[model samples]
Target chain A: MYWEKEIETMDREQLERLQAVRLRETLERAKKSVHYGKRFAEMGLDIGGIRTDADVEKLPLTTKDDLRENWPYGFLACSRDELIRMHSSSGTTGRATVIFHTTRDIGAWTNLLARCMYMAGMRRSDVFQNMMTYGLFTGGLGFHYGAEKIGALVIPAGAGNSKRQIQLMRDFETTAIHIIPSYALHLSTVFTEVGVDPRRDTKLRLAFLGAEPHSEKMRRKIEDLYGFRAFNSYGLSEMNGPGMAFECPEQDGMHIWEDNYIVEIIDPMTLKPVPDGEEGELVTTTLLREGMPILRYRTMDLTRIIPGPCPCGRTHRRIERIKGRTDDMMILKGVNIFPIQIEKKLMEIPGVGTNFVIILDRADYNDSMTVKVEVQKEFFGGDLRQLEALRRRIVEELKSDILITPRVDLVEPDSLPQSEGKAKRVIDNRKD
Target chain B: MISYQLSIFAENKPGRLAAVTRVLAKEKINIRATTISTSDTFGVIHLIVDDPARAEDALTKAGMTVSLSRVLAVVIPDQPGGLDRLTQLLLTENVNINNAYGFVLEGHRKAVFVVSVDQIEKAEALLEKNGFQTLDAEALSAIEPFHYMKY
Candidate 1:
């Protein structure tokens, strides 16, 4: 009944035993790398002493900075000849973090993604349309191989041709799509403008949304608008792009596949593990990978492990939706704020559209925040008073939630700059 | 009775008005009069055009949020007291005007004052009862503004 029923449904005791064995193997492979070899030698890490999953705490946490400091092949465990392909982070800020994969590593990643897609109800008969751009970014190829492994007819329609995307949906009877949440919402408008109601015209019933952290309300809005069930997917390039954790049919939380990786949530300040059900940073260690096996890699994504067993019977532990990244947290007036907080509040309001941007500036030693939201066309009745009321309502709601009064600005529909990839939601103009 | 005016939602940015005019120009739609009112970050452009329905369609197809609203186009004498007389009647009757724009058809002879109000039928009835000559869409669009001027 499952992709790998034996592994997927392995009990906790058996899973821990399997993880202990894989942990030792992963450490042995990690030791072959130049970066981890010196660190392990310095810490005198005894691979034999690591007997259980809890023993992962002994390993020093690997960070993005460490990956950048090492540069290209510092983390490659296997010989250069064994490498098949490599994916790198966009490196918009600093040095790009790169990860190499052997043929076997690619196979393991493909199987893991297949398991995830199957768990989300994708089938062999389904025609999957992958709308993500395939490049150094892992989202496109990772899911593409996985969907193909499931025997689904894969239509690799890369991002940003709303008219062509709709035409493909109609022509191919595309039953499923892998898209970012923002692009999914943006495509819904095109469906109407092109006079094709997806609910009636296309056979699309399933969508896989990932690559960007989105709210539950945003998920529901996409589902309601497109008349499909959108499954939230969580993954990073360090952990092989998008098959890290995925929502089962229950939709309670995503189950992190523990067979291939060990997951830990830790306090960012203390760098210590937080108990299950408490929010903290996600640290992961990859097993079953040959080319580059990361040990205790700090993900910087904030989420908590959902305690208790999921009704889907997958013994793997579940994780809550990623709240926000540690680096993306905005500190204003001695208070912490996240763009998702404003986005969540705006989604609940009736007249608010799918697009918004948060601008930060400072004047007279005071930091100020301004949220610009697009006014929905249906709600704009050519009345100034109604628009003013909507703006005031957004400000009040945002203040009540974020604990600071923010200046709200309403703009024309689709006026904000939109990217084909993850939406750029913040613009910081303050000179720090 | 009531004439239609195209109201467009726009951002307060450079070249936005040019973009709007480009759309209308491509469609060969003539603008009778136009008024733009801006708030902090956005503005609304209200246009009295020759064919409001066609203008709205063209602007919307060009990806602008355009809405057609019912407005009253009242004919008044092209004199200083012409608009004052209309305002006095509206003030006494408590008929609030949300947006208004005017242009003289013939200098010192006649002018058109376009006013957008919430209660269109009531405003129209009150204006007619007050002996005010209100123009419908056809008459307002057909007005020959500055036709009496010779260069």
Candidate 2:
């Protein structure tokens, strides 16, 4: 039964052949995008000359700085044929990154997203209310298209309108949800405020969350909200948004759609590939995308890709949940701080919510970072002393790790805006 | 009736007022009259100036956060008992008078009392209810043109 699927059970040789065939077409298509056209020329390689995966990696890795240098449309590798649509990535720290998707690319994404839903045992009879904000952005459209393609009735109940989202769930008998992990807790709050028991009133069985790195603690919270199993979906808008990979019912790790995108882990400093179980930066290549095919695009997200058998029986490569971003490190007093580390420390605090902000500033020629947090009410009911204790603990942990002291502020739950799509983490207060 | 107002932040140092004036002098901004309510560390300086906005901006850029507020200018009886009546009414209203000062209309013999209050609208309302008079922005500007002139 495990070896039933031909593509899933394909030998390494067959998989290599599949990747090479797709690479050839993607390269030919890449030449049309303005960004890649000049890049391929400068690289001194023709689309037809490239033969294998090594040939693809030998070209060069495209960084965010390179994308910034080209700006807006510098790296479009496709035109009319592969250029079906374009959208922007959330740019909280700097300029927004844009993503282009061909019609075929869109179909492949929906197919993968459908496979994700299937792995979780979601059926066409299930109703899903996607809570992503619709715009010239991939997050909302990615889930919306995928849900519809899977033949599930989807409500484009964009984020923040919790009142209607809840009503829609009750009225439509919504069985599944596709939204940011944070918003799911907000739903529980609305349910309680409206005097409805989530486990009692509605039929929410599964939740698919993406667009931000959430803690395992948050996954448990969402699961407890409606007695539904919550799964994490991972993707960047540059790589066709939210459908890139998702967790199966087993919840071991996210399954990377290797048939379409080649995922690799490389040491960010040395730029050399790391073996399985070693944490490194996630670099992705579009094995099948026609419009604007990315060749070793550095995602800046750090994770370990574990290649092996999944209980779900999908041959897709599994990536251990993200460690954090290397480029987007929060520097405090010459020390590198990451939001995921903050999340880990925060999750241990009983009352703390998953959201936190690293307030950045310049003081006396050194960076001063303050961690401001919000506590959940069930864990902390407006107790100032308890908040103070948590703050002291956080300061101690941050100090021990960064070797610099920081001020920690505890705020009320839901103090930070429940992000509609992208979560804001770093706050630069030097100017404001 | 006349009123003059100036906004200053609540930061304290011995030469803080001097710093404010020095910036005013460099910018050619004139000060007509001034009073500062100071605690151990914070000061709220309510002064009459040629330009309030520009002066506020200069002070903000210079690292002093300031907020502009309106004060009431009332015509007192020009007698000692006249001042007592207003302050007593204010005490009854529970409004702290942060600062107070005035100038005499030399020709008219009218003594104008310029009073700053924590609650401007309520203090003005109580004064108006008690049959006192006040000045609008234009009239206040005429007395303190240095304030209405922005930059």
Candidate 3:
């Protein structure tokens, strides 16, 4: 059943050969790509010269602006007929940069996702409720196709309407749900709103969530209510989709399918790859992609790579869950505070409500940060003095973490703004 | 019993006033009289409601900053001499007014004055003995189907 040796566990020598051959094909393919053609030539680099992975760092890295400038068809390396499916990024200011996938490309992605799901202890007999939407976003279709390819019965439920998701889980006896961890919390919230106990009612055993940064404190919260193990899935829309890698049962880190893709960590500032185990931007080159091939594309995500045999018996290289994003880092008083650190702290305080806003502004010459946290009035004694004291406690909590004093503003229950899409955690209004 | 009136802080923005009113309206709160004291970033709105506790509860739910302090509500005659009488009484008692706002209680035969007095219970007893009417802390917030804002 594992005839896919090129994807499983190929030795270094064999991998080098496959990568060398595939990389050449990718180079030729890139030369003809409308976006890369003149640019590659202007950069004065020969695609034929790239004989090894070390040769990749020499090529100019692709940026998000490059994709936008080229727009929909610029990055297409193959004809339309060969490409069976397409996906695009959300929030298009101009034209959307469409991602094309051929049948083989789809197969490779499905296999990778299946392997990720498999690592999380999913089975062919398991009924997976696909909660992510299937459309222009890669998250939905990527996970949906992967589940079906694994011989599992997949429920294409998509997202939103938590009641329907819960009902289907109970009716279909859903064993695994493919959704982000934050959305699963929304499900538990709905259960409480409707007076249904999630612990006693839900049949969900495992939840796979991605597309945004999360924290381990949030992981424990989801596990506590949904009665399931929450696994973090990682991927980018341009990088194919949610199957780039996934957390295994041991939950140490996500395992990248080294056989099908080449993973590297590079210092985004220095323009050189960092040594293994150092935190840097992730770059990937899909060895098997036919229609839309990405070579050493800089994925702005930051995490350290662990190159070792996984406890799950898979020889793939593992990566710790993303610590934070490089672009999201805010420099305040010469100190850096990532939104992820706030998320971790927020999760530690239960019933603090999911909605919060980190107001950022300049106080004096230094940067100021105020976290406006929402608390249920029932928790407070309806006294402003008492409420102010609670605010002080939160200020103390965050001060210990950020090493800088922050003003804690307490708002009423359900007072914080609610978002229909991703929760807006940071409201940075700094001059920078 | 002595009662205190408070001027609470609110962000200066659109819909902020409406939001504050909606909370009080939901509870059938009666704001006897009010005035917004504002600055560049925020504003403090001094108010006398019919039911202070109920209004405070509602405002708290809506996430409004509120605080309580003793203030004097003195009754003045409807004639021009009414304010003269109340001010002279406070002056004689050596009570200084932090601020003052006057509003005629509709359908009432007399005018009412809200005074940020140094002492409230003393003024209330003095004004009552002088046959002047002064609203209590609860009465100030209990404005029914309010004439202006359903306060």
DockQ, all candidates in order: 0.38, 0.03, 0.06
Ranking by DockQ: 1, 3, 2
| Each prediction's whole-model lDDT (CA) | 0.85, 0.70, 0.71
Off by over 4 Å in 1: A91-94, A329-432, B1-151
All candidates' TM-scores?
Answer: 0.60, 0.63, 0.60
User: For residues A78-183, could you state the per-residue lDDT of candidate 1 as single tens digits?
Assistant: 8999999998763122234788999999999999899989988999999999998787778889999999999999999977788999999889999999987767
Misplaced by over 4 Å in model 3 are: A1-6, A91-96, A192-202, A329-432, B1-34, B37-151
For candidate 3, lDDT tens digit of each residue in A215-287?
Answer: 7877887788878888989887677878988887778888776666778898979868888889999888777
Backbone clash pairs for candidate 1 read none
Q: Compared with the real two-chain complex, what DockQ does model 1 have?
A: 0.38
Residue A141 lDDT in model 1?
A: 95
For model 2, what fraction of the real interface contacts is kept? Answer: 0.00
Q: What share of the true interface contacts does candidate 3 keep?
A: 0.00
Give the C-alpha miss distance for residue A43 in model 3, angstroms. 2.1
The CAPRI category of model 1 is: acceptable
